[model samples]
Target: MKINKILNNNAVVVKEDDQEKIVMGAGIAFQKSKNDVISQSKIEKIFVMSEGNKKFQELLKTLPEDVIELAEEIISYAEGFLKVPLSNHIHISLTDHISFAIERLKQGFRIQNKLITEIKTLYAQEFSIGLWAIDLIEKRTGVAIPEDEAAHIALHIHTAKLGASTMENTMKHTTMINEMIGVLEEESGSTVDPEGISHQRMVTHLHFALNRIETGEPFHDMDPDMLELIQTKYEGAFVLSQKMAQFIKDEYEVSFPASEVGYIALHIQRVLERT
Candidate 1:
């Protein structure tokens, strides 16, 4: 194999026997350049992305090299820790997720994952891998990832552990989240700045709320006094939550807990304030 392009010190684009491949290993591309002969023993992994998976190719091009390296390392840990081979789709999905997450953090944005407890309870091994991922990321990037983000990573690992059925459900949940966000925007009489942290927080809230409801996990009880305060003070936000709750019942045929509804109102109030 010969290096066609260096993605980073640990990664390279190469060609072997007329096939283009992404090869990675520690320091494999160190001081190396295009057309350099690659030592076969140094190649740890070869990503032979199918031509049909154009998104994977695009991710390869668009992802920052460190994020690529970090995601691969995390994936490797997840597989080993879980003792299972994951869907190749994770190579694209998780890498893209990490890239965005890192950029979001750099921009001083934090997305809270309300699903953390359920995730820890249900997917312990994957959660462990998520913890490991955050530690490694902090060491490399000097950014401390919140525990909630670890749970988020665990969900990604768990999803990638299965087949199309699980992926389909995940996609369905994502679509529903987008619709719920649209409803909130309409109710608040404001368009969410898609790139803003407030938007991320709202989306995260809705996404986890859906997961929490469907999984039958217990939601935290909102304080009665504080809840009444918000209901009275942020009346519009409370209305927004009520409309969203009704939408959930009408569309998904499920009802969010009253506590969850209160949290939704708080999230709505925050977004409205930021907007």
Candidate 2:
């Protein structure tokens, strides 16, 4: 493959089959120039990014080479352990996140992962890989990263594995869920205990509900009559659930099915009782 552009001493952009690809290896592009042919054995990794995903181009230009290599190491380990090829977007996404995180830590700005517990419970495999990455980072840089970073990294891995953009949506959904819980608390005259099992279950339920909404898979087994009975008996929870649904509609421009609303009400009622 002929080098089209040089990313760094260790990496270069090359053309293969008339498509642009960035290839990386130790000193692969050293003493190389455009139109130079790269040795096949010197290429350690090739980044075949989607045409729409051009962020990596800028990301590769600014990020430290070692930080990018660290992300590649972690991605390789994750693919081997999970037995799946992740999206090419992760190459830039994860590298950008890690580099920024390392810089933030150096500047004494520690960002906490608010969804650590939920992340661990919901995405165990991804979270495990994140932990390994954290350890690897510390070993290489001698910088201590908070365990919460594991959860943050896990979101990137999970989104790559799913071949979707749910990582950003997950943060947005969690924020919405927290606001919804605040609405529930205001209506029920109770504060949510974040450490309680009920809170965990409710968060899990809402997470799954959002996932279902994305997949267009609303609950199908709830009885219509039972929903009516609960709406009448649990007036506060039902009203709160409707308000939450309206919030969802306003934010998402989509409405949940009746069963989904009913399930939300049931979860709201349980949270009210526990709190």
Candidate 3:
């Protein structure tokens, strides 16, 4: 095994002879520095791997089309699900976790399983954070997010890779946006129809949409056509939101707080923009 490139003081790139693979991970050889020999025992996790340099090259070749496409969805979902700063690596971690979690959820088992239970069992101090996320979502969106969604989202938001600032900002934006719907209605003086088709329904769908956007991920588990429809509707909602904001300021002398609108715009850009 030999060192390839050092990513940071505590991380490095290496080629493992057994697999003939080049992998990236956190390493113990922090002192030797970049382009220096690293001990095998120091590596923490293999972030990525390829059988050979050519294979690695090939993998990267379609990255723009496939790898990044998939990763973008993962990032979107993680942004909402975790409410944290996520890099491409966080996207990778979430992709791996969600694949299994979704499979388990599909198998008729609840998602708040042993791992979730362990959070309360082990680190009780942060248990309230999970509860807080669920409470905030429930209070703002009125959707009663499935318990499974709450548990998994809590995990993603609290993971080490997600910075505190990122998590806090995302959470604040999500909470505010969910609650902002009421203000829009108040300003518009429009009442939601009660014929099972109303602004209330739009609000609900927007909640779901915001959930995906906040997490910076796509709901691959959902039907592609249906997802497309939902995306279209959300875009329409975004435009409506902008109009409502303008109307509020113009007619009611009230504005959708600029800070809140900025976050709403981010959600719009992430969910409606074609990547």
lDDT of 1 at 147: 89
* lDDT score at residue 44, model 1, on the 0-100 scale: 89
Prediction 1 TM-score vs. true: 0.59
Candidate 1 residues 32-98, lDDT tens each?
A: 9899999989988888747633466667667777888899899998888888888878888889888
Q: Model 2 off-target regions past 4 Å?
A: 1-6, 16-20, 26-42, 48-58, 114-118, 166-168, 189-198, 232-240, 250-254, 272-275
Off by over 4 Å in 1: 52-62, 171-250, 253-275
Better of 2 and 3 by lDDT: 2
Cα distance off (Å), candidate 2, residue 213: 3.8
2 or 3, greater by TM-score: 2
Model 1, position 35: C-alpha lDDT score: 93
| Best by the lDDT measure | 2
Q: Give the candidate number with the greatest TM-score.
A: 2
Candidates by TM-score, descending order: 2, 1, 3
lDDT of each: 0.79, 0.82, 0.45
For model 3, residues 67-153, the per-residue Cα lDDT tens digits are 223333444444555465554444444334544444454566665433333333322333444455445545543444445454454
